[model samples]
Target chain A: MTVPVPFLLGAAALTLSTAMQSPARAQSAPAPQIALSCAGCHGVGGAGEGSVPRIAGYDRQAFVDNWSAFRANARPATIMNRIARGYTDAEVAQLATYFASLR
Target chain B: MTRLTRRAFGLSAASAGLAFAAPATLSAQTQARLVIIGGGFGGASAARYARIAFPNVAVTLIEPKTSFVTCPYGNLLLAGERTLPQITHSYDGLKARGVNVVHDWADGIDATAKTVRLRGRATVAYDKLILSPGIAIRWNAIEGYTEAAAEALPHAWIPGAGEQTTLLRRQLEALPDGGVVGFAIPPNPFRCPPGPYERISLVASYLKRHKPRAKILALDAKDAFSKQGLFQDAWNELYPGLIEWVPLNKDGKVTRVDAQAKIFETELGTRHRVDVGNVIPPQSAAKIAIDAGLTNETGWVPVNPRTFEATRARDIHVIGDANVGQVMPKSGYIANSTSKVAVAAAVAALEGRPAPEPTVYFNTCYSHVGPEYGISVVGVFRPSENGFVETPNSGGVSPRGPLAEQREQRRLEALHADAWYGAITRDAFS
Candidate 1:
């Protein structure tokens, strides 16, 4: 089984964002439970660590576009492609807004 | 961004503060009473999220235990990597967050009265009730296996720190070198599909160090299991010639056991005498769910995929292992995720607001094959007309491959698993 390169890149981006943000700003509202699930891989607040990317400050439009691409199979993905299909376009937008609201 | 209306503004204000003070506009409405039973991952999370999501609503968690010992990492205890204290969690953090933590058994649910009767306590009324009462062992599913038999053979399937788990560990320790250890794995749809295999791996890990000559025989009811390839690969690589798995086709299904003689008989009529026997009997929804008539003929509660409300009872939602027909596996992650969705719907109903739609659920199950070799499976699901379906291309098992990459990835996942344990436990209890 090969780990998807795009997934790793996405996680790396989250890690970069985590390093740039202040610890205080990282401590925000309690994430809705769905988003909180990401903490296992994306770090607390989606800060990202090591290979994971910083998703907390992602542009809402970018977030939506990425997930939409994954859902549509229009992007190179590993697990995200399958995960993205779990939500409707509206939920993707809501999640994007949720993550973007952090910073 | 949509402009915040008065109601949305009040909700935002209420969420911003830790105190359970409802906004003036929201306080005028009837006080909402949300009672959640069985303070496991699902119920505890529902209680905490309801407190934060709707401060005006009163959240009460009815659990018999003051502290919970999670099943997530209980295998580590068998390997002597972790102690009981490390996995125990207190409900004080939940109480501090304005949740009423009631220590009592929820004996029965009076759905008509919208109340839950407690053992030796007053009945608690609820506008919305969430039941996460995990699984109940089907005592007689395997002939000769009963509650009394567990004390001798010890299933250790349930999440009790000093009880079943400790008993199993003590049994393993007392076994002499070269003693045979046997496990009778249940059929499909059991809690934590990958769990028994993980336990087998950990037991092998322990025996490898303490009793290098000891052997493990796993008689499984199913032909395949979660992450089978991954687990088999790790067993071969790490503890070669130590573990043997017998599938159902080979008469792996255990029919009966003589606890006194320490012998297990399988469907093939082959009896195996072992020094230690770990029999994970068949399972169903907890007794409370069956008693309340929330469960179906399948012995699992059927629920609306969208709201997780019981099909038979209005205002009562079931999440966690008790709920069935969901695409998601019966694991802790799914329990936590479904709990949030249930809480969100319940709060919306209490406030007379439209429920949120297009909900997404996620689950990632990490199994430690050894101290450093971990594997995982991920799934993302959405409600469909029939039931919940996995989002295509979203979830899959951990990658298998070149030894170097596999080893590194497994090590990283082991670390991630620990982090996940902390994050999820905190999410539920703290």
Candidate 2:
């Protein structure tokens, strides 16, 4: 069981690394430079300010996982909930990973 | 400085005309030659997507400036929360994504030749032309204000490489402790619905901190604003003495601006003088759209809502603020979403595939009442047999109750506004 746990953890790490390196499948291209606009209010580290929560510290997989939920009306807010609906599944993930890396 | 002579102007015009006449002959049809006119949200998105969806496509986006400073977050900058550089974007990312980015003004489009002429001696032909040239300031609409006179009293409307945003910012900063700021809000069907209101709130926030006694007098052309009730409550609670809401009928209509005297005249012959003036004048589709025979009497391009292809021009599509799109605000989100549908329709037409039907779209306008508190409206839309219609009773405006948590939620959303701006710009240009 101990041996299996080590192997499983190593595989998970490999998977995470691969996902981060690969270009988002939905985008068909690398993400552009405009992502910097998010850094100010959201924090360069994603440690959000005032009412904005800590998106930077969110789990990478969880961040990617929540985007579809955000887009499909599962999540609701004055802005984010509506904004989340705009991106493709891949954009959600790309953004998710970028912010999660700051964590 | 070089003076504009008749002979020089004529030569420049003739050369530009010839540039439009030149035809671009690519080897393959699948290898599309795409020329996008504007560098705003629509044009930038089209250029980015064209490179991806059709890798073989030769994508060329033409704009006069190398950098694109967005009007979306410019209000925050005016509020002193953000800087000009924070909202600015460069074309380098688009160029890196396999796009031919050209820093030249689009003079005119030769539909017959399928080419666009530049102001200089250059032309680019295209298999499919996407024009998202944004809006133009309607100078003649206001009585005493012209393009030149706007220097003293800045509109700060246009996005990039100009004095508009910076000029307005400096004026706001320079204003006396108890001075008044007059915002001449434009009529409906403008670029950003919540924009003028947001501007008012932002300036009010600045006054609340620095001047405290300064006031924001909003002279709107419309009876109601984007998020009127929510904004009014926020203003009263946050900065009671700092902001004043005046509707069009309540002696708020601005007839003209005397820049020298800093006086704004109303319809009823009332003159209100202000120290800092930020007048968002009436607007129309950019001059490029009108010149291409795409505009109707409204000075905006009428397009098939299903495909965003121009009704008046063949093989040309117009999106963004320049195109007349009902059921969607001319917000960046809608423009970005509409561009996707337009791209898919164009690709399907080119590939002989059935264009997707019932294209659903959405728009969310987030306006910050202060730093942390924000309010917004979310509208979902789908193409109906008649036209694009909002999903009936599907989404509602921001909550009315003055709960502390709700205001905090508004603040979180405002922060998300910056996040989303980053994401959308990345999606479009990066």
Candidate 3:
């Protein structure tokens, strides 16, 4: 049986995420680790269920713009604004790219 | 070779094929096995995350029940807002995702041998184990409150099969129009700190429509609770004169329960007679965890902050209310959120890498106080010295205001609570 590409990587998820990091965040926490937290509310893999909006397969630029808006309080949100403030700019960028990569 | 030696060799060989750029040579039989115990918020989420993120690792979930009833929205069933079918979830979703879902009780664990002995006389091996067996009501923690007594005075705490919740609902239905309902709330550090109070609120919401003259006597063992101010505010406004909450300072701690007489006796020896009785006894980690020697004297497991690996065991990670995550409240939201971290850490250890660092865990516990009225508390935690610490200024409760001023806010939050339930269950089961 042929295993999927990700499954072949196994624990390499951590190292692979680290490999894709920018210089400023070269030693930062992996993107997949941060993205997992969103699964609590956004559904596994950010596939939206019910009223929770879908984050998976989102446009990379749109994800970044939405994060910036929520962080700046320029948009109305019940919980996202508060949750956004807890994450750094670099982490948010990484999450944006990570979710965008999902199917 | 010895069983232990052969198992260690199998695990190391599994890790050898997991390098970043290694060829895909591992077959189904050669994959690492991840065995998860219990199928609640923690185990289900961990199983699902493992399938999505670590597809190379085979997952086996051992749970006694084929479907799960959530404890989060159980209070809504008492209020008649939701039905039992609404909260029950099937393991079919996990099976569809390629997880080996076994409906068997996990009788014991052998951490050294890396195997779990099931009640069905079969032993399954695991390269890494995730134990999320949830909590067990310490029966008789209150005098005269044994497991048998629970048939009459149901705790309705565990999410097992939805029987306790449904039994409590039937009792409420049988109560007279002007009868009294008494709740013996437990002390702090129990599963869902805000749960008992929410039960009281929803039961009151039900009584107000069906039995207006009904009274609620909530005798809490502790003085403070999650969102105490907000819960009290809702009680006074929506359920005025219907809820009577007694704090610990006022002799509110229940020392004994006369289940047959339908009575609750306090520490000060005051007896309270009621038409219906709900007793939430003290709790600890589930029996399997205790039997495996994973729990400490406090009856809870202590784990590394980042890895969630039990301090007493190797190749075993503990999550959910079973672990001593002191800074975080033992809520389903925390269990679901921490599960992914635990899975990642377990896989990292299999490959001999460090546990994910600087991990930020998020929790949002939303509770409904009345019809179209809801409230919640948000907390963000990160690993600190040997435990977790709340992220400063990151999370807070819903803004407190009078009903008339914040009517729309309450209505929207109630809707949001429903949406959250749907999304979270899908995340875990579907």
Which model scores highest in TM-score? Answer: 3
For model 3, the docking class works out as: acceptable
Candidate with better lDDT, 1 vs 3: 3
lDDT of residue B180 for candidate 1 = 95
The window of 10 residues in a row where model 2 chain B has the poorest summed lDDT is: B1-10
**What residue runs in model 3 are displaced by over 4 Å at the alpha carbon?**
A1-31, A57-74, B1-29
lDDT of 1 by residue, B108-217 (tens): 99987788999976899877899999999999789989999999889888875459998999999999999999999999889999999999999999999999999999
DockQ of each: 0.13, 0.06, 0.25
The order by descending TM-score is 3, 1, 2
Off by over 4 Å in 2: A1-103, B1-30, B403-405
- Write candidate 3's Cα lDDT for A1-103 as tens digits: 2223344344454444345445653422334687877876677668875666888889989988988898788997776777877787787888888888777
Q: How accurate is candidate 3 locally (lDDT)?
A: 0.84
- In model 3, residue pairs whose N, Cα or C atoms come closer than 3 Å (at least 3 residues apart or on different chains), thus clashing, are A7-B56
RMSD of each: 9.6, 12.3, 5.4
Candidate 1 vs 2: which has more DockQ: 1
Candidate 2 to truth, TM: 0.79
